[model samples]
Target chain A: MSTATETPAQHGLAAHSHGAGTKSVKGALDRFASFDVADHSVPHGREEEWRFVPMSRLRGLHDDAALDGSDYTVAVDVDPRVTATSVGADDSRKGSSTYVPVDRPSARAWAAAEKTFTVDIPRDEIIERPSVIRLTGTSADRGAAGHLVITAGRHSKSVVVIEYDGSSSFVENVEVVAEDGAELTVVAVQDWADDAVHLAHHHVHVGRDATVKHAVITFGGDLVRNGTTLNYAGPGGDATLLGLYYADAGQFIENRLVVDHNTPNAKSDVEYKGALQGKSAHAVWVGDVLIRKEATGINTYELNRNLVLTDGARADSVPNLEIETGEIEGAGHASATGRFDDEQLFYLRARGIPEDLARKLVVRGFFASLINRIGVPEIKDRLMTTVERELAVAEELAAEAAGDA
Target chain B: MSTLEIRDLHVSVETENGPVQILHGVNLTVNSGQTHAIMGPNGSGKSTLAYALAGHPKYTVTSGSLTLDGEDLLEMTPDERARAGMFLAMQYPVEVPGVSVSNFLRSAKTAIDGEAPKLRTWVKDVKTAMDNLRIDPEFSERDLNTGFSGGEKKRHEILQLELLNPTFAVLDETDSGLDIDALRIVSDGVNRFSSGGDKGVLLITHYTRILRYIKPDFVHVFVGGKVAEEGGPELAEKLEEHGYADYVGEGAAV
Candidate 1:
């Protein structure tokens, strides 16, 4: 895969079907890429990518504000086969995945960070327990820049979970590389406080015959945007990307992802589910899959589902699939945004479950399958507890809206 | 003994045009230790009566007095009505994905009993009930009604009828889509519930096949939202022979 996009017009795929005029003029992959912040321009709300996001809520992460705040602390707990350390920007392994920043906030985050947190899994070792990393922001008064790199050696298997909480205006760029025959799982949970603003970009490079499972759980934060890019480094590379998010009243959560199938005999599956409640609760999901001319016998499917609980709550889902070659096995995409199912609620309530508890059960069931597929036992229970707490708050907000109406 | 009295009940459902009345001044009484079979042709409002009795939001009781032992049932929500000893085995049970059958049953039992059941006895009771119904033990772990066949869904409804043990059960076309074996199994389960000798049953169906298994003391022929004729079990046998042509006109008989 080419790392530089000096002549993006010539490099972009031509005449592909999806995201025609909604995203950038070209395909999603041909977007300007660079490490220097000056190369990318600040986005106004009118831009297709920024249309769904409120630019004012970014806290100047996209513009000239300094991202040098140190009001945060990081803690890491790793399995015996893994090592966690911080390296200077000049570390040889920093950009080993050959991924450059795609957006202004991503570029700014890369240019502003002096050090990167790195996690390494040695070759041929199977990790028994997942490595856990926790980053907590002490205050939201100032913004911060963050960078992380996770590399899995050949034939090894490991799971890494990074959890974020507290409050801050944070921008981050994450790079993941899996070597041949490696199996890697990475989960990034954004559980920030209601006052926090977060913008993150995750670029994953899948190696030959390797498998990677990546999940993002976004439940809190005043405004959060997560953009992920998946690139296949060799044939038979398989990637499963899953996400679960809930946006409450006055909150904005957006997830944008693209999968580039530039290699043959590769597979990719993306599924994201979200629920929104209360006034002005907004959740947006944009999924793009591109099957290049060289990507033959490839199989890919992407699905997005959103449930809107009450009036004035909105969910936007857009799925685009572009296949330049018909020689691939199969390619399909489905997107659905629907209101809370009244028939399911009535069924539960008629079975002697009270209305409130019935609603809770429906919402819980909505996120259960996705959470179970995360496959991390330690985090599953904690995630369910968090879901219940969020449901309590959502119910209160719904009741308040009902009373006002 | 408990008595459910539906006196001159009227119901209407909202459509795109306006409110269309489905049930017009229907009267019936179900007493403990007695089974009343309400046989009707298609679109005769038999299902509407079941839903209205269970307080489904889609049906409006424009004017009616629905009472269980002299207490107004219209004032209660669906859950409260279940706690008051009323159950409706829906013909088309909605599938609730990601909620296991075991959890859903336990929750409904808790709500009806006002407390959680003893874990030991509850598990044993559920196991015994499921075993009698010939349901696989692993079925309890699967999502409720999701991907279930027609027979499995009907059997699950009967299982709830046996476990919840409500005072009155309104079985709405429970025998509609079942084969002979499944029909017999579901009827046996219903008979087990009614065999307690203190439960009232209002069995609603378009056919008399299930009446042969669980005989009803009274048979009411429903036509055009009201009872066209009322008699003993002999009425069901007669309808089986003539097929409702005597009541609904030869042109309308199925």
Candidate 2:
């Protein structure tokens, strides 16, 4: 009878203003090192960072094998304000932007690169249309390596989309730089062939008061490992990192991200969602945030959720936050991994939606929120189609498994 | 035009130990255009009847005969039963995280109708139905039942009833969590469905407050999984004044 506004809090967790991040410091502090390749060696699956990875299947990307082949072709749809050029290793922008090797795989990618593919957005210029860069592999057996540098000049605004396709053995290093007061959006899509193997590391640096929206969408690979690090150089910077991945039968897809809040008055948010299906399908997400003692007045939160669609599919999720000082805006995280919700299924079925279609609706709905955050229609539509295809395959596999039983 | 016949229905659920019986030899008949209200106390198998008719897998019908116009209902799956024009408004509507209300409604309608609804008119039809239920237009884009208030959930159920237009509906305690205004709106929606004189409603409730607005044509007092008594609307009036104390003696049977 009365008009009352009941707006529930966005997150179900209780809001704590003081010492919120300190409470998450339960275990002994985890270690983080500077971006030095020599400090790391070939992993034998025993290290904390490399424990979840299957080392035997890496195809020597972990070791110092010569990346001696040009098995992929690079194509770009150029914008007037944006230009892509192949430069020698000595180009000022080649290694000047956020270029640092975090681990051995990245260092190997650096040492074996033939040339650098560099795309630069000039200072104070805004590009209305998005630029597209596509890499297509020539074959599956040949091993390939490459390096890429993308930079947005001071006060410039632009969007760059990088897409990967075809099948091959690949290792690559990527560097992204957002200068002071610039706004940049980078969307990297890994849509490989069924036999492709890709290992990559992406390092991003944000300048004073800059804004960067970075998204990684991974699908269609036998094995893929992607690592990203975001470090702010000045105060008032904002970064939004999003990832969506789908892993099918006998596939491994993992994303590891670290957001280092080293400056005061900055914000960072990370959200990643994945769905796994079929036998031996595996997906993993690891998020780590470190706030230095000087990084006061910071707001950060991360959420990761996984949906396992069929039997034998596995999902691993871990979120860790390390804060040196509790004097900050707020910090928290949430993670969950579960199968299809029976209550939701029954609710939809009671509405006369057949069980199969009801399941599709529920799965698609799980990704709807993250997909909308992408803010680009073409990518959103294409991702929806990809999700639908994954659901179909999962359904067929479930049927076959049931038949065998 | 249609008749939902339930005869000697017995249902049970599986617990950690073993099978546990819930309903024993219950019988009722709801013909088209009739509003029959079943009033009972908690744990008296009132909600079990609603779930049993909806073909919930957890509820095993050991012995019973449920028919929708002479077709076997007990043999059908939950979705099949819904497709056969049976509806059950749950007491606690589940929250689906990612599915939007508009998409879910469209998918359900298409599944039941055997074809996709005409795009141009379907949008208008949904708008009209939502407007009639006093539901905001933006709710169509939100996740299905997630983060919705109690009143909002009840109104959404009624919205589906108006749009889906089922032949028979089993509403289980739809008025429990609703405010007075929401109760009236939900009652009006049910009234509109039966006003067509081709749809039947089985209203399961614990209070007589909703009956003041719904105005059932028949009232049945349920106790111990059995229909203790039945009569015209006057039965509800009598029970409202006195209570089920006359029929249910001191925790006699369950």
Query: DockQ of candidate 2?
Result: 0.62
Question: Which candidate comes out best when scored by lDDT?
Answer: 1
Candidate 1 C-alpha lDDT tens digits along A1-405 = 121112223212323243453244245657779998898899888888899998888888899788998789999999866998888988877777778998899999998988998999999999969999999999998889998999999999999999999998999989999999899999999999999999999999999999999999999999999999999889999999999998898999999998989999999999999988888999999998887878888888788999887778899898876766656666767778887677888888787899888877888988887888788988999999888887787778778878998
Q: What is the TM-score of chain A alone in each candidate?
A: 0.91, 0.90
The digit string of per-residue lDDT tens for model 2 on B58-112 reads 7888998999999999988888999999999888898887788998899989988
Give DockQ for candidates 1 onward, in order.
Answer: 0.49, 0.62
Q: Candidate 1: give the TM-score of chain A.
A: 0.91
Model 1 chain B, poorest ten-residue lDDT window? B245-254
In terms of docking quality, model 1 is acceptable
List the RMSD of every prediction in angstroms: 6.3, 5.0
